[model samples]
Target: MPQQELFNNIYQTHYDKVHRLCKGYFNGHEGMAADATQEIFLKVWQHLDGFRGEAKLSTWLYRIAVNTCLLQLRKPATTKEIKTEQLPDVVAEEYNPVTDERLKKMYGCIQQLDETGKMIILMVLEGVEYSAIAEVVGSTEETLRVRIHRIKKQLSTCVQL
Candidate 1:
């Protein structure tokens, strides 16, 4: 199959999952997630020819998504204030996750986790197989399981508040 066709198939199959993973990293900021998702695909398109078949395609795509989000998060904020009298559209959208206290606490707890824990839990929430997640995060399956159990324990105590 042609690269374009293959990429389309991959994007269609995985876009929502990748977007959700990015959103998780950002504690559900839609605009940031959308930006990271776009950056991830651009990288994928640029490097598509270089993808070796050693890992599952979804696993590889997820690795790119995670890295892109981390890079975006690490960059110093370049946003400037607009002197508009109106609130931002993101605020007006009214469907944000932060609207729910429980969920907001959950995202806060996730953000407080170590980088690997955040990546692991985000991928797990995306319903990526444990094996695939383990591969992307570079942990053995058994170690991943143990880490997940510990993360769940930690998050539960935090979120129950």
Candidate 2:
């Protein structure tokens, strides 16, 4: 496929997943999610020629996403939280519980996790397979599994507090 066509197809295939991950990183701030998603795709476009197929395309996109979202979070100006109430119907599950008190606590717990832990948990939450996640995090599957177990234990403790 031509690069533009390839990008469109890739965007269609992965936009929701990428957006969901970005939103998770941003604590469900939809605007930031949208902005980060755009920035991610823009970077992908700029660097499309560099993809050498050493990994699955999704894995590459996710690696870029992890880095991009982390960069967005690191920007001091981006700390201004502009929360709006317009949750996209497509991502309705993302804004669960009608009342958001519990959800906020969970996001807070997630945000407090170290970067790799945060990526692992968020990708797991998005239903990414364990092997794929391990690839993205550059860990053995067995090690990722152990970290997942520990992360879950930590999250449960954090959430219940």
Candidate 3:
């Protein structure tokens, strides 16, 4: 396949997942997530030629997305919070004030986690497989399982408080 077509196919296939990943990193700031998603694809375009198929394309793309988000978060200028009332249609449709409050607290707790923990939990929430998540996170599946258990326990305790 031509390089452009390949890139387009990959982008189309992975854009929503990458966007969601960014959304998690940004605490649901849609604009920043979208910006990071664009930056991720730009890096993908630049690096696609060098990809040697050693890992699944999605995994490679996710690694780039994670790194991009981490880099963006490290910048001092990106630290401010932006509030927006927009919620996903599903969330809005099913909204209860109590549920919304709980969800907000959960997200806040998630944000307080260490960077690696945040990434792992986000990927888990996204329904990425344990093996795939381990690969992306550079951990053994056994280790990830243990870490995820601890992370979940921590979140549960934090949310309940």
- The C-alpha RMSD in Å for every predicted model, in order, reads 3.4, 3.1, 2.4
lDDT of 2 by residue, 27-141 (tens): 8887789999999999999999999999988899999999999998998883554656645435554565645667778889999999999999999999998888999999999
What candidate 3 gets wrong by more than 4 Å, as runs, is 78-94
Whole-model lDDT values for every prediction:
0.88, 0.91, 0.89
lDDT tens digits, residues 1-161, model 3?
99999999999988888888898898877788999999999999999999999988878888899999999988888356665666753546555889767867887898999999999998888888888889999999999999999999999999999
TM-scores, one per candidate: 0.88, 0.87, 0.88
Candidate number with greatest lDDT? 2
Least accurate 10 contiguous residues by lDDT in model 2: 86-95
- Which runs of model 2 end up more than 4 angstroms from their true locations? 78-99
| Residue-wise C-alpha lDDT for candidate 1, range 1-161, written one tens digit per residue | 99999999999999999998998998887778899999999999999999998998888999999899999999998996454543333545465555566777888999999999999999888898999988988889999999999999999998887
Per-residue lDDT value at 118 in model 2: 99
C-alpha RMSD of candidate 2: 3.1
- State the displacement of the C-alpha of residue 124, model 2, in Å, after optimal TM-score superposition: 0.5
Q: Candidate 3, TM-score vs. the true structure?
A: 0.88
